[model samples]
Target: MNFERAIIIREKTRLEQLIERFNSKAQAKFYIERSGGDFNFYEIENEKFYESLNEVQKSISKHLKLKIIYRSFLPTYIFTENDLIVVLGQDGLVANTAKYVNGFPILGVNPDTERYDGILLKHTPSDMNNLIKEVVKGVFETKKVTMAKAELNDGQTLLAFNDFYIGADSHISSRYEIEFKGKKEKQSSSGIIVSTGAGSTGWLSSIFNMSHNIYGFNTIGENEHQSQINWEDEKLIFVVREPFLSKVTQTDIGFGVITKRQTLKIESNMPRKGIIFSDGIESDFLNFNSGSKVEIGIAEEKANLII
Candidate 1:
């Protein structure tokens, strides 16, 4: 196994400790970044985080020869060569796991064990030292995850670690007609969601009115109203256990499902005002006036995860 390119991804507070622990055993590097930007709130200042990172870098430079990098965004750099990676924070773990899928075994260290849902990491900060020792001793396992891919009408393609969403923009309703394999269905509701196995827990689960599963989709309509459904056995099944009625027409809202082989199409009158979000992060708004078509499908490339 190659041990010269060991990379450690962690938060500011735990950088020094991780570096000191792994530097002697393997060639190690560190990455640090500020948290809390996705929800439009700033948790830490850039200058403050960078200043602390610089101090940590200097301390590590005194004892080891390695590079210290900064991660400013999610889905950090892709893996080019085989290496042992030690991740130290929740965001770092999520970002690194989403980006690096090339059969590298990752050891996740939970800096804050009690606060967040560290289900993926599942290891305490105190366990970092032991985890590194185990990693060097070849004592661990890795898991694989699937990714959803989206291809637009313009031949542009994108990937999602969790799910791909096509829906109305914030505060605006969307009206579209759907076509599946030459069969047309007019949908005057919100939008559609296509998810992979890893994304089956969140939106998809809620839409189907069931617990987390392997693969599914969720279509959320306007005004917090939704019609949950799933595809199975060459047919789509809609769950109407707790049925809902449309407020505008007072008609029982129905769920929908389309076969996998069917070519599903969604065209909106307000396509420009509508939007498409992937994995709750990446997004692109459509322009109906320009007459663009948004196409989505299962991706050929799947994500590899170390669970």
Candidate 2:
């Protein structure tokens, strides 16, 4: 499909440069501001930032076919079919980025390059116009990123772009009775992390004390795999880091797999108090006493990123 319309998502600092860049190239129809309400720090206050973006939107609209839209807080609108979505924010905008632009190939423009991790975004604002041109012209490659889907026993379903963690919220260690396919096993560790290939370099790598290979976890050499479990049953592979212990020391940490299973269930000892999140956003709270079960596996659909 030909993407005629482009959605520009940007913060206040990069507004002028982004406008100039967009105007010089593609004809953007919608200007979406990276409002600071969803962010944790460095927020541009409601009065100042909105007013600034509003004026800039008007100025850009005068020259090109652009309509400036703003939400007093974070926006909840999903992208229209075949719309090109761009995100401009630091780490705090990760969840929102994943939520709004799931199926679409999202291009992230890092406004704050020094502080940002640049996990989702591959480039900065200065290089965005060329990237967008490449994307619209079908000259760029895309990576298929897998996502995790979780279903609680109460019939609640959630999705994670990174990993799903099950463990104690309190200082006390929590035990989990885990079942893979039909076989059952017990884990007495502080928690268990079910991570996606994209998340392997983040939380999973940290827990395992390994370096992240951005291409994917499959590229890791066999020698490295000996220390970690890199086997794949299908699209989903299970890796357990420092399992069966409340506290782990480098000398005692070991990794294993829960076997190749299409469906896996985890019953937490402290069910009601357990937490389930996707890419750091909490989706639902586990109600253990009422027989809560968190099922983890590959999502039916995958995420596509514009690289």
Candidate 2 stretches greater than 4 Å from native? 8-75, 91-96, 137-139, 210-261, 283-290
On a 0 to 100 scale, what is the lDDT of residue 156 in model 1? 57
- Model 1 scores a TM of 0.58
lDDT by residue for model 2 (195-281), tens: 766666667767644534443567776566432222122344445544554353221322333323566687766645666655665
Per-residue alpha-carbon lDDT of model 1 for 48-130, expressed as tens digits?
Answer: 33443444334334433334333333245665445555555564345335543454565554545444566556565445445
Instruction: Give lDDT per model, in order.
Output: 0.48, 0.55
Off by over 4 Å in 1: 1-3, 8-78, 85-87, 91-107, 134-139, 208-263, 282-290
TM-score list, all predictions = 0.58, 0.64
Candidate 2 has an lDDT of 0.55
lDDT value, residue 92 of candidate 1: 32
Q: Give the CA lDDT, 0 to 100, for residue 48 in model 1.
A: 39
